[model samples]
Target chain A: MHIQVIPVEGLPIIHPGDLLTEMICERVTFEDGDILCLASSVYSKANGYIRKQDEIVASAEAVRIAQKTHEDPRFVQAILDETTDVILEDPFILSETVTGHVGVRAGVDHSNIEDGMIILLPPDPMGAAAGLQNEIARITGKEVRVIITDTCGRSFRRGQTGVAIGWSGMTAIRDFRGDHDLFGHVLEITEEAVVDEVAGFANFIMGESNNGVPAVVFRNCTRWTGHDNLHFNREEDIIRKALCKK
Target chain B: MHIQVIPVEGLPIIHPGDLLTEMICERVTFEDGDILCLASSVYSKANGYIRKQDEIVASAEAVRIAQKTHEDPRFVQAILDETTDVILEDPFILSETVTGHVGVRAGVDHSNIEDGMIILLPPDPMGAAAGLQNEIARITGKEVRVIITDTCGRSFRRGQTGVAIGWSGMTAIRDFRGDHDLFGHVLEITEEAVVDEVAGFANFIMGESNNGVPAVVFRNCTRWTGHDNLHFNREEDIIRKALCKK
Candidate 1:
């Protein structure tokens, strides 16, 4: 099946408590089985998760780590506050967020925010994704999947690719455990992370630059439906298990 | 600039010594600046990298690890032979391939091959990609980037996504270090793995099922050209540095 990614452009700068569904609805129309991938930055900004540097109080640990990493103490404190546990401390603070995503600075972003402010990941990405999906369904009278994505660096790979932080209305993992390949070999351990792949595809169009398009709609995704679960919990994720071994 | 991914269908089952460029060219025409993403399986198969189970002799270490992970000793031995270092033993064999890609089973894939046979990753993926790019350019007289991709499980993330194992004719990393974001914040650490993203996008259309479409042509990729480097060497990669802290 062929898939098409259409960028939803012309979105005004999102603000705290702003209805992202409303902004997106004004820009584009949705179709049944369409997967709308939204950048996590917009979700964080629209949810008022942006924190000013002046408002943060550096902790003793934050100060100690800040000096080592050559980072602003207040900014480091914001990252520490958002982290559940520090995974790495040398070159940068690789920490696990409360939501269980392991990344540098607890997935807290410093770029794309106003001067002296940093954008924290959406407090509840799954909830945000679910709400947005439902709202879009209500407006268009069509079922669509919503995936909230963020750009993150991966271990053993250079550069960054978009990852699904939150998703709704579609199965995040496409399990191919018992399936047979063209040569009739029983495929084992072949679960495809369809959501993350979709997020990466969307990020290619959204781009890292000033490509105002923050949201992309993927149409004709044959594997869009069929699963019961919409959200991927990091506590039970494979990536977390693999990382824990390290 | 909009991007369109068109699958090149009707290729015969590829075998060793098959001319992939001719096979692809016979089915579709090429345009300048098009990015051609080829699945690594086809390359490996065409290059006769497949190994029969009987051909492998399990070593003492392979037998020991196989007992723990419950995998076939012979298959495990093949993986061990292909690996430069074992990264993890528990759950499964996560190892670094000789090419420096850190993944399970040293990226030795068992699926899509005949029973009792497995496929190894393409040797010298960069050279293979460059050769393919040059062959296509020679035939069509049009400049096109070539990316050889493999679907592999990632650390700390569920499911599998397409990754660029080799590429030619494009800058693999889109460095945005000194660039400014929409809010005028100097963007740091925003290098996008453009090749990997393109591979992931192509894989979405390729799917894991019996979609015979192995190659995809990406058109209108405005960011497709202007850069020289195409290959990603893991020795000098950022992910290696981040993981070295452990």
Candidate 2:
């Protein structure tokens, strides 16, 4: 399938009641059966969701959080360096973020943007994904799956790959229990991490450090189901853990 | 630095004394400094490394290897299904043969070509890698790196990625201890898995099946030293035990 991950740019500071569809209408569009993977970082960027730099000032709370994670407080300042921004809480999650992804900085990022502003993941990312899916379906009159993605750290390997924090209209896992290998052995240990695989492939097109391609449409995957599957923590998480074998 | 992995095709059967440069020279050409990551399967196929199907029918040795790896006698039959044309072993490895790596069977694919022929991995993959690198350097007089790749399983993740079984002219580990994070706290968990990272990126272009692009060049990487210093192991076996923070 021809899948493309396009980043959205040029929006104003988004507010609580801002019209996201209107703001993103021009540069972004989708087709039926297309899969779009969007990074929530851009959304936070447009809305000026940042933690100010100077204000953090190595506060006792910041120092404590850093110590808790075995990180330096000055590292917190570097995270805050992208903007004069504060997250009101520590974004470096030990496991999953509020969005339930084990991503770097809890999916909160301060890189490659104006200083004094930081970006937190979209609140209720699952809802945000469903909303975007519905919005695109309504606008284009086509069924499209939306997966809101953020970077995540793998347990065994270093570095990060974009992960599906929130997704809509997709069967994120493919169970392969009764399947046989070419040799007739029952195919075990072969359940593909469909979501993570898709996410990793999408990341190449997503670009690193601000190429601005956030959403991409994937075609030719007939195996994907067209239903609301926003709960990534259950099924998807199981498949992820199984694939990781830990 | 930009790195890409390409598949190579049109390989001929190989014998012990055969020259690989001759076999691949027509189909796969490389420039100076281009790293070659050849799957062992292709190397085996070209060398005419074949095990006759019927020969193992009455052999107890065949049954022993097969039983060790939990394979059915039919596995011998399946191997015959792919190639009576060339090499065979009673059973390949004791391990599960990692779901996605290249070996006599995993990537010794026939789909890319016609049926009734099997490809085996290169003999002495590490040695071949070193030789290939030396050959490329001799012809072009430019330093090059060679990574003889095969698929292997990870302890934590289910799927496999191509890893350097044999590598030359590269320091696969980029240790980052004593390096300070922004916070100045010691960066303990920061030693990067340089080989796996490079292999992961390389697989994107190498792909699962046909796309006939062999070798990828990674340019402008300041850290990629063309020195042979890599050791391969299972991810689970390698991870240090987690310290209990009392």
Candidate 3:
């Protein structure tokens, strides 16, 4: 099926207690069954989750946590700027308020933003997926799926590929073990990452340079559902994740 | 640069002492600097690199090597079928005579061939590169670089991307660290694999489903030369060679 990605822009700077769903839905076009994938850093930026350079005075509690990894104060501050909520302190994964993307540190984007401002990944990406799905359903009277994607490093290849950190309405893993190869061997070691593959394909359309298309409509994907959260799996859980850890 | 890839087909099965460079040059058009990437297995098949399945004598040395890796007898036979010369048995890299490609097990392919046939990787990829480069240069009177490419499993990713196992007249690595980024941070970590990137792009055109395109011509990449193997810094070397163990 031909998929079209549209990047929605022009949202006002968001503040605490803002109606985020309403604000985003107003700007974005919605159709029932459409899957909207948003970048987490953009969400963080609109929400004014900015931390000034001076506000980063590390307290005793912060110092105690940083000591476990032997990290410096600035490193701790960098993490703080990109994080809305700390999930597991040991592994140091964080949640962002903007894009509903969850991972190890929000995509705090030091590349494109001002020195004082850092972007965080979305907080509770799974929750964000559910909310987007529901909001689209309520507004358009058709069920839709939402996937919050973040560009992250892979252990093996040189560049980053898009991953579905938060997903609704899709089975992430496509098992093909019993399938036959062209040589008639029962195919093993070939579970296709359905969500990540689609995300990567969409990422190509969502050009790295100001294409402004943030969301793509994946139509005719009959194997997915919008109400399920059980299918989104972490890359680390798979054997292939070992390649990018370098 | 505009690149064209075409597969070689319809030639009679090759045998030992067959003259490939001249024979192939006669069948196809060559411009100065056109790179020919052939799968070693196809070359081996044409060159009579095969052993009958009924030839059931297993050597003790073969069994010993197979036992060390916990591999089956059939796999061991497959490995033996394509190997023509043993280069440095301690490191375990082999060289095949059929296609002039060298690597582990000599690119003996079982993927797209009939039973009772084994295809070896090209015999001497680097030598093949130089020979083909010279042939193309002689015929077209234009300097050409040749690259002998093969599909090798990457350490991290699930599928294979073509790598330049051998090349002539090309800068394999291009470092752009001193350049400015969009945000003007000293651009580091952009030393691209020019060979691998070109190979990957070639693969998109030379698909597995009988496209009949094996070699591609890349023009306007004059920065690449037929001389000088890429000199790797310690950090880049660590990443490049880390994927394939000795």
Tell how far residue A12 is off in model 1, in angstroms. 3.2
Candidate 2 steric clashes: 62
lDDT scores in order: 0.79, 0.48, 0.50
Badly placed stretches (over 4 Å) of model 3 are: A1-33, A46-53, A58-72, A80-108, A182-184, A208-211, A221-246, B1-70, B73-246
Give lDDT tens digits, candidate 3, residues B90-150.
2233433343333455555554455544455555656667766776667657676666666
What TM-score fits each model? 0.89, 0.52, 0.51
**A138 in model 3: Cα distance from truth in Å?**
2.3
lDDT of candidate 1 over B85-134, digit per residue (tens): 77667678877876667777887877776678788888788899999988
DockQ, per model, reads 0.49, 0.09, 0.09
The CAPRI quality class of candidate 3 comes to incorrect
- Poorest lDDT segment (10 consecutive residues) of candidate 1 chain A: A223-232
Provide the TM-score of chain B versus the true chain B for each model in turn: 0.89, 0.62, 0.63
True contacts kept of each: 0.52, 0.03, 0.03
Highest DockQ against the true fold, candidate: 1
Model 2 alpha-carbon drift over 4 Å, by segment: A1-25, A46-62, A65-93, A98-100, A155-158, A221-246, B1-246
Q: Over the stretch A111-199, how does candidate 1's per-residue lDDT look in tens digits? A: 77678878899888889899998898888898988999988877667778888888888777777666667776666756777788888
Q: Which candidate number has the best TM-score?
A: 1
